[model samples]
Target: MTTPTSCAYCQQRATQLCAGCRSVVYCSREHQKEHWKRGHKRECKCYEVTSNELLGRHLRATRDIRMGEQIMCEAPLVVGPKVAATPLCLGCHRNLLAPQKPAMTFYKCSSCSWPMCSKECEKSPFHLDECRLMAASNFQSKINYNPADPEGKESAYCVIMLLRCMQLKRSNPEAFARLAALEDHLKERIETPLYQVLRANLITFIKTVLGQRDWPELEILRIAAILDTNAFEVRQNGERRKVRAIFPGGAMIAHDCVPNLRHRFDDNMRIIFLAKRPIPKGAILSISYTQPLRSTVQRRVHLKQVKCFDCACERCSDPTELGTFAGAHLCGKCKVGKVISQNPLENAANWHCQLCNVKKSAREVLTQDARLQQEIESLDKTTPVHLEEFIQGHRIDLHDTNTHILQAKYALTQLYGTAPGYAMDELSEESLKRKVDLCEELLQISNLFDGGWSIFRGNLLIDLEEALVAQALRLQLASECESKLKRAEELLEEIKNIMKHEPEEMQQMLAERQQILNAAMAPFSVGVE
Candidate 1:
């Protein structure tokens, strides 16, 4: 865990990491001198790495923590590409740009022919160790970028992160030890289909092609399983560029669907975690490993598949899904009734309608739900007609707060402001009002599950604020515009509080948003939100 540095004299946040010992920090040179005289000279030392297995390798607070306080900031031990449906740069993990013309080929590394973004990425330190081994063994990448495939097919990217972890054993023994010590769940994984596939393909390829024969087969597989258990999906600007990273301190936090801790990555790729709410002393810090908007069944399946545990958190056990009813559907016999799982903790249990008390088998519910999801997925999201039609058609079977409806509504909010035919300025008064209704209703549902400071909530507030501003612009009366502008100001403040610890890209957007609101309000001599 990191020891946050403070200014020696003034006790303000430190902005400089010390050069001499690479340990302490100071806000200014004068404070550094004062601190050096007052016990810093003798006491300042490099932080010692420590481990605890008190709760089987989870983190604990050494001191009292307040809301929005940064507990720890850590650099990733290893960073590499994820198993992606889309082709991505092995180094940066951005979606690979498809060749404009048919004859052009995808980029590859000069040394090993592995997929990479450019010549600069071909020489990255992270790629060097794996590149050397692959080149030495005469291995070449078969991963190709296909322009026609929206999700570019590339199965070979899966092995890149695993290869990087294996190379650490020889290149850096200390990091290798830390990597080995993480939980692997080898007992559970060996029986899984993925591990079976790895045995047939990945294991044979490494030994026969890449020729790392000296490394034990089980150990190599164990490292891969360990990464699946603990590695964080690190990304900047939310969805823009994503890669897997292992942060020893940050990984120790446990999981909760409605987590009290929120995290963000810095420009240097350091994980910075802050309290999402007022956490008491000795409370175990946690972060959500799954999406907040997903229903209990969805979250449970994802957690069990990836993290290998069935969550029984407060929100997960509640049948109403923390009152959002994101998974609930209307009864077939009685349209007034809402159907929910009888026992949320057990996946195979029965579901019953609340008003009519009619029962349905778990298999029946699962199958029908999947069909609906598939039908929704097939809709073209670029325009609003199909989605609007879907909502109208399913109104009897699925309620307003059903998961598929919520998903469609979220998509429409984005489409309204930027879709080809529905730009904000081009929207009719009725269309703008429709957008406001969707945002406000979704936000109320969001509060039940996502709560105050979640990223889901932050994004919703942003959409709502813009809608409110648009409504203000359309209104002719002074009293009506005043009401809309005040509500917009309220939402703007909430957006800042929620996204304060987000990435630099998000921060830039926030700054620009504030400026736009300021410029709009200046004509009325109003203050900044």
Candidate 2:
């Protein structure tokens, strides 16, 4: 395509091109700013949308992207509560307060008879569209406010985001068009039990009670499926407040077991994607829709179930999981050999012992894995004792790099510094050493998978650096103190770079960490007299 000579803003003859995309021309700096604010900013990105047979729609860098470069930041097209969610204010998406007294009722929206925090919430733009629709239809919400079970999931919240999406048909047709253009995989989901529930209950309620009969059942179901396929889980105010929002631009970035990009939400709830590693021009920009620590079988199964595709990514194809053996088990037959899948992508493929060639059926392997996972899950993790015992007990069966062991080790890293009687100051010398060792080991595995400026590596660095600082303070010898403090400084510098894109609170924590490290090093700054 020939570059246009006309300005994107005023359609006047133009000499300047956008530095970011170079696709649009601007007459002047003022026109550039105005054009960007008008919406060119969303279009001006390092990555462009691309598609394939496997990923359907995905993103690729249009130009070389530096490590930690901000790729895209987009506001949600629609935001609402999750389908099955704990009681939260629909207006603000915060957890609702428990009913205080004998009345056992929540503060309801006076207009819609739906539960909200206050009259202020009733007038919120998020609530008004649905409030007017519900009130006009005389639809009273059946969301029971049980004082005893205030934190329990409320099924009534399921209709909220769907209603918001449906409302966009009339309220904002352009947005609805963009939403409708997204891949919903409706055919893949329509027969599932969840869709069956929607068909029986949700469909009837929306069409009959809410009087959306003009909307076809299939079209409404498509919207639900779209939300499932594309929505990003937004966790705010730490992990306490959780909701879901969909960004059309964000939804285009496809999934990989090991992703090149990591995302975080800003205060305005805009989703920002950053390059976790340097990307050559035309490399696919990706994010992990599943946890990195999960075994290949577990991750593949989850991706298929949730994202409607099998991941044949490089990590998934490797039986040794890029030499970490995260998905392999210690062979019961050989007692020394690791059991690995014949083909990591095939669900029904046999697993064989490396030493003896002894085979285990996929069912047997999955069953054993599930039992071990359940055992680990059921163990009390408040203290490190149970986790340590579990790791020790399974050492012969699970081995060092087994997924279960890695998970337990990761948990122990968090528990050692924060759990009761295991605080950084309270930890014994042995436990401090153990925490450092765990962080180092996890950091290596993180490098193999989610490497280079990744959040996982950054978090491990934080843990390792803090432990190093503690070890430095604990040592009486100046040489040991200097060595550990120097290492801590190195780790802190990397942590700052990796987490520079993090939220303000995390940035503040990083500043505090630097101050603490500085205070620790102050004594060492002066020469021995």
Q: All models: lDDT?
A: 0.79, 0.89
Candidate 2, residues 396-460, lDDT tens digits: the string is 88889889999999999999999999999999999999999999999989988899999889999
Q: Give the clashing pairs for model 1.
A: none
Give candidate 2's TM-score: 0.92
- List the RMSD of every prediction in angstroms: 5.6, 3.4
> What's each prediction's TM-score?
0.84, 0.92
- Model 1 Cα shift for residue 254 (angstroms): 1.2
Score candidate 2 by lDDT.
0.89
lDDT of 1 by residue, 192-231 (tens): 9999999999899888888878878898789889899989
